[model samples]
Target chain A: MNWMTTIFYFFGAITVLSALGILFTRNVLHATFLLMLSFFSVAGIYVLGNASFIGVTQLLIYVGGILILMVFGLMLTTKLNGKALVTENHNRLIGVLLGTVFFSILSYIIIFSANFEMLKSNKTLPENAVEFIGINLMSNYLIPFEIAAILLLVALIGAAVISEKRKEKQE
Target chain B: MSTIIFFLPFILIYTIFAVYGERKISAFIQDRYGPMEVGKYGWYQTVADLLKLIQKEDIVPKKASKKLFLIAPVIIFTSIFCGFVVLPITSSWEGTLTQNGVYFLLAIVSLDVVGILMAGWGANSKYSLLGALRSVAQIISYEIPVTLSVLCVIMISQSLNLQEISYQQGILINAFPDMENVKNYLFGISALNIDVTNWGGVFTWNIFRAPVLIPVFIIYFISTLAESNRAPFDLPEAESELVAGFHTEYSGFRWAIIMLSEYGMMLLVALLGVILFLGSWNTPLPNIGNIMLANWTTGEPETIAGNLWSVFWLLSKALMWIAVQMWVRWTYPRLRIDQLMSLSWKYLTPFAMFLIFVSGLWRLLMI
Candidate 1:
C-alpha cells in the first residue's frame, strides 16, 4: 500500500484502540482522555480522506471544545479525597445488547447503502474545499444549519437557566 | 518536513535565548542586573540552566499517576510544536499548504489544554490541579475572542490560507489579476485615486486595508496574551498563590520541557499575530515617490536574497511581538481569577463579537 493508505490505517487503528480503551478503563479521567484520543484519531482519518476542513473542525469542536469541558466537569465534580477516581460499570448485559444492536445497524447501513466503488475510486475533493463547504452551507444546507444553530442556542439558554436556579437554591 | 527540520533546532535555540532574554528584560525593567556572570552578558545562562536540568533527577511523586505523568510533557510539547506545521516561514517555504491552515493551527495548539490537564490531574497535587483548572478556563474563554478576531481577518482577506493572507499584504497583488477591485482602491478608500498595489508596506496591511481591523487587532493581541497565559492574564501560574502552577510537581527535564512549550506558545501566538495583522514576511517600508524602498527590501519570491529577506522580516516582526509580550509580563501584575474571567467573558468576547459584525459590514463595502 501507499503512504496514504498506511497513514489511514495507523489513524484507524488508534481510533479503534482508543475507543476500546475508553470502554475498558476503570478510571473516569483515563476514559475521558482516551475518548479525546478517539476523537483526535477520527479527525486524522477525516484529514486522510481529504475532508480537511471537517477534520480541523472536528479537532476544534470535539477535542478542543467538548473534551476539555468534559474533563473540566469531571475534575470539578470528582472529590479530591486522595483516592484514584474510578467509575463502576452497571447493567453490562443490557449495555452490551444495546451497543451490539446499534453497531449492527450502522454496519448494515454502511455495507448495503454505501457505494464501495466510489470508495475504491478515491476521488480527491476540490482544492478550495473550505470555500466550497461554506457556499454549500449558506445556500443548500442553510435551513438545516439554521435549525441546528437554533437548537444549540436553546440548549445553551436552558443550561444557563438551570445553573442559575441551582445557585439561587444554594443561596 | 524540511520546515519541521528547520523549526526543531530553531525552537531549541530560541527557547535557550528567550529564557535569557526574558531575564535580562525583567531585570532591566526592575533596575537589576540579570545573570551577568554566566557568559558574555549572561548569554549562556539559560544553556547552563538547561544542562543543570538535564543532570537533575526526574521526580515522580508516590501518589502520581505514572503513565499520564510520564506522558504529559510529551503531549504538551507535541501539541504546541504541531501548530508550527501550518505556519508559512517564507514565500516558498511553508510547513503545509492546507486551505484551512489558520484554523488547523489554532485547533491543534488548543489541544495543549488536554496535556496541561493531564499534567495537573496526573501529578495528584492540589496546587497543580488548581493551576490546570484555572489555565483551562482562561485559555478556553480567551479563545473565543481570538477566534472571532481571526475570523475578522479571514472575512476581510476572503481566505483561510496564511500564505494567501501574507500575499494580500504585499506588492504581489499584481500576480492575482482577480483582485482588481483591491488594486483599484488604496486602503479600501475609493476616493483616494492613488493605487497602492505596487507599494508593498504597512499601508497594504489588513489593519490599514480595513481600518476597522485595528480594534480587532488589539482585541486579538489581548486575547492571545491570555490564550498563551502571559501576564497580566497569567493567573494559572501566579507563583504567589499556586507555586509553579500546573507543572509544580514536575522536576528536571520534564519541567524544562514545560518551560520550553510555554515559550513556544508565546512565540507561536506572536508569530500568528504578526501574520494576521502586521504584514507577514513583507517589508514595512513603503515605496515612496521616486524611492522603491519596499521593492528593494522585498526581494523576488524564489531567489536566495528573497528567501533570506522573507525569513528575516517575518522573524524580526515576530520577535518584536515576543519582546512586547515579555515587556507586558514584567510590567503588569497578574490578574485575579474573577477579574480575568470577567475581562474575557464580559468585555473581550462581547467586543470581539461586535467587531465581527463590523467586519462583515466593512467587507460588504469592499465588495
Candidate 2:
C-alpha cells in the first residue's frame, strides 16, 4: 500500500522474526546477537513512528551500551566447546500451552478494547519533539527523572560495594 | 540523494589518498622514504595495493561461520556509510539534515561495534574474540565522555541539528564590539561587517566559545581517538600481541572492506570534529574572494562564492585533522588495557561531566 505502511510492516516483520530467532537459536552467543537484531528492528519501528529521539536513544543505550555488556558477560562467563552450543529446556508442552493461553488472552483484550481505534490514526508528532521531551522532563516529569537518577546512583554504589567485598574475599 | 551520488566517488578517492598520506606520514616520522617504487612520490601506491587486494583470493577459515564471516564487513561498511549521510561538508551542503542529525550519526557509528563483534565471533578464534571484546569495551567506555562532551555542545547550541550548530558557529565573537556600527548583510546582499574574517571565525568555533569547552573539546578528541581504535588506544588490534586482533582470520577483499570501513570511520570522526567544534564549512576570512568573484558575476556573488569557500575550508580542516591523527599515532606508544580503561572511565568521564556542568552554567550566565 503506502510507503509508511510498507516501512512499518518491514520493520515489524524484522522485529518479530529476530525475536523468534532469539528464542529458537540454540547457541547462546547467536541468541544474544539475535536479541540485538530485535532491539535494532524495534528501533527502526520507532523511527518509522516519527519518534527519532526515542529511536536513536534505543539504539545508543540498548543496542550499543547494554547489549555489548551482556555479550561480554555471556562470552567470558560461559565456555563454548568445539561442538555447536545447544540450549536445552524442559517442560516444553506446558510452556507452549502457557504461551498460547497468554497470547490469546492478550489478543482478546486488544480486540475488545474500546480505545483500539486510536491505533488507526496516523497522527504525527511535533517536529520539535526532542525539545518537547526536554521541557517535559524538566517540568512535568521532574519527579520521575529524579527518581530514575537516584535509582541509577544507588545501583552504581551497590555494584561498587559488591565488587569491593568480592575483592576483599579474594584477598 | 544527489549528494550521496556525488559523495560516493569522493569518499572512495579520498580513502585512497588518506591511506597513502598515512603511509607517507608514518614513513616520514620513521625517517624513511615510503612507497617510492610504485609511482612518483608514491602517488599510485594505494592504487596498486587496491588492485592487489581485488585480485587476491577470498579466504574463509574452515572453522569460521560462513554467513557471519561474509556479512560482517558489509555491516561495518554500511554503518560507516550511513554516518556520512548526516555529515555537513559545508554550512549549505549536507545529505539529509535529519532532526536529530548528530544523534543519528552517533547511533549509526556505534553499530560498527556490532559488526566487529560479529567478525570476531564468527571467526571462531580466541584472539579474534579477545580483540572484539577489547574493542567493544574501549568503544563503550570512551563513548560516555565523548557523549558528555557532545552534550555540552548541544546544551550551548540548544539544537541537535548539525547544520544549525554550524550556523550558530558562524557568528563572530570579535565582531560584537562593532555590532551597532556594522552594516547589515541579510540575504539582500547589502554591505555587512566583516565578521567572517579568518581570525574572527577561529574565535567563533565552539571549542573557543568558552574556557570550559576547551577541556570538553580535548576530551571529545581523546574519546574520538579511543572510539576509532587509533594508536595508544588501539588495543583491539594490538599487532604485537593479537596478530591483527579481531580481523586475524580475514583476508583478501573482505579484509580490504574492513580496512576501507576503518578509513571511512577515521574520516567520519574528523568530519564530526569539524562540525562539532571547528565550525563546518565556515571560511576563516570575513570577505573571502568577494573581490575576485565580483568581476565575473553580474548578480550578488555571496551565495555561490560563500558555499565554494565553505567547502574548501571544511575539506581542508577535516584533512588537517586526519593528518594530526596520523601524527599522534606515530608519536605515542600504545597504552596498556588497564591504563586505557582508567584514561576513559577514571579521568575523561568525570572531567567531561564537570565540563558539561560548567558549560550549562556558562550558557545560563551568558544568556
TM-score of each: 0.95, 0.88
Model 1 RMSD, rounded to 1 decimal: 2.2
Regions of model 2 farther than 4 Å from truth: A78-83, A114-123, A165-171, B1-3, B171-200, B287-303
**Model 1, B1-367: lDDT tens per residue?**
2367778899989988898889888877886554665578876767778789999999999988899999999999999999988888887787674588898998999999988998998898899999999999888888889999999999888988888888888887655435544562466665566677777788888888889999999999999999888899988888999998899999999999999999999889988999899988888998898799988898888788778988999999999999999999999987889999999899988998898898888877665
Candidate whose DockQ is highest? 1
Residue-by-residue lDDT tens digits, candidate 2, A1-171 = 999999899989988998888878888778988888899889988888778899989988898779977876766656454665569988999999999999999988877765744366866689888889989999999999999999999999998888874435553
lDDT tens readout by residue for model 2, B63-124: 88888888999998888888888766654566673579999888778888888988988898
Q: Score candidate 1 by DockQ.
A: 0.79
Q: Which ten residues in a row have the lowest lDDT in candidate 2 chain B?
A: B292-301
Off by more than 4 A, model 1: A90-98, A120-122, A165-171, B176-184
Q: After superposition, how far is residue A88 of candidate 1 from its true place, in Å?
A: 3.3
